[model samples]
Target chain A: MELSVIGKYKLLVARLYGELDHHGAGEIREAIDRELMRRGVRNLAMDFTNMGFMDSSGLGLVMGRYKKVSAIGGRLIVCGMNNNIRRIFQMCGLQRIAIVADSLEEGMEELDK
Target chain B: MNKMRLEFLSRSDNERFARTVAAAFMLELDPTVEQLSEVKTAISEAVTNAVIHGYDGSEGIIVLEGTLDKNAVKFSVIDRGIGIRDIEKAREPLYSGKPEMERSGMGFTIMEAFMDSIEVESAPGKGTRVTMTKTVEAEDEG
Candidate 1:
């Protein structure tokens, strides 16, 4: 997982790589949580741009992030879901919680507003 | 008839491993993304149930066999674990032999939803075997 930040207000963009199963969710949860607090990031955009696979554990990651952002008086947005990952989002109804978009620009656009 | 067989040690990691193999094997079916996801998810649910519920987290062997039968694909997950007492009851929604694992008890339901045909054969004190078949039937322009 590679994480980078750009733009003012310091948006934390996490580029997830590999499968998001239970075997790997613990690291992801801790990684994302640490970054969220360390960066003091309010508006967050998770770029699944490089993510190849995700399961229920991955869905839990998204849900946990949503709760974190809500607690901080911030907003959460996720983008770059491929066809495979998008199907999971739709199946689990995670789309309703996070703003899914075509690209990072679109996601950031929604988050900025 | 082309065949591919993979055997994985019954472990949590192997559950995702089974789903990966199933997804790749179904590639030639030219399945829609939704269709492919269904297959993968169904396989995941079943494999998890077998290892977690049937075997009760004990060490075992799981054999995943894939066969290309004409226009259809036949895949079977064979597990040598404590078999289900009732096949019909097992297939019912919210019926799980193990609930402490937080299992949704929807394993068979999801598998049935994805595969065209599913068959289970087991005997008391004998291991259970669950076989699933999916045929990509051509649509008619009626």
Candidate 2:
């Protein structure tokens, strides 16, 4: 999985064209970690719009990122999560830690403010 | 497509295979994009547990099997590793054997949430097997 930077927020939108299970989680984690460290940025957006699937590994990735960004006093937001992925997020109570928005623009706005 | 089986090498590898297996098996029902994700997530969690805690992060094999029936899809992962002493404890939220690995211990929680039913069988020092089932929307209600 590869990531692209959007604006001031290093928007790491992973294509997630296929499945996002344990195998892909590591790669995506690596990409996000590198970009976040390089940019010295905390504001992060994970776009799951195109992602076909997510497992617990995906949950671990989200939790790890939340800890990372929180440590640096930055924020992590997720946008365009499908129904199933969204259900996982809600079950894990991730909504309390990470902000889930309708769109990347909304996520960016929430984080920016 | 024929029902399939895949033996996983590492937890990472299991994730990819699990997603594919679940997707392919569930495709028979022509589930929505969302339903596919649920099956994948459930399968991923079961397989991850087999590679990681089920084997204590050591060398072991995880057998993944998938089947599509008239009502729903079923996936099972079997591993002969360090079996869990207490299944109930493992299923609890935030219960992970390897905290240092950055695991949230929410794997089972996610699995149960995504799948319609989950059944686990295990014996200490022998191994563990997790069987999860998900029904398509059309066949969900009685």
Best by DockQ: 2
What TM-scores do the predictions have?
0.71, 0.83
Residue range B1-142, candidate 1, lDDT tens digits: 6788988877878988899898899777777777777777677767876777567788988888899776688888878888888889988865767543333455676677668989988775677778888887655559
Query: Model 1 chain B — which ten-residue stretch has the worst lDDT?
Result: B98-107
State the lDDT of candidate 2 residue by residue for B1-142, as single tens digits. 3477887665566566656766886687889767776676677788778877777667788888887777578888899987889999999998878877767788888878778889999999999999988878684556
Angstrom error at residue A97, model 2: 2.1
What residue pairs are clashing in model 1?
none
User: Cα deviation of A46 in candidate 1 (Å)?
Assistant: 2.3
Give the per-residue lDDT digits (tens) of candidate 1, residues A1-113: 88777657467778888667645666877888898888887767777888776654565567677888879877777888887677656655667777788787897777667
In model 2, which regions exceed 4 Å deviation? A1-17, B1-11, B57-59, B66-69, B137-142
Q: Give lDDT: candidate 2, residue A113.
A: 72
Number of the top candidate by lDDT? 2
Q: What is the interface RMSD of each candidate, in Å?
A: 4.1, 1.7
Of candidate 2 chain A, the 10-residue stretch with the lowest lDDT total is A10-19
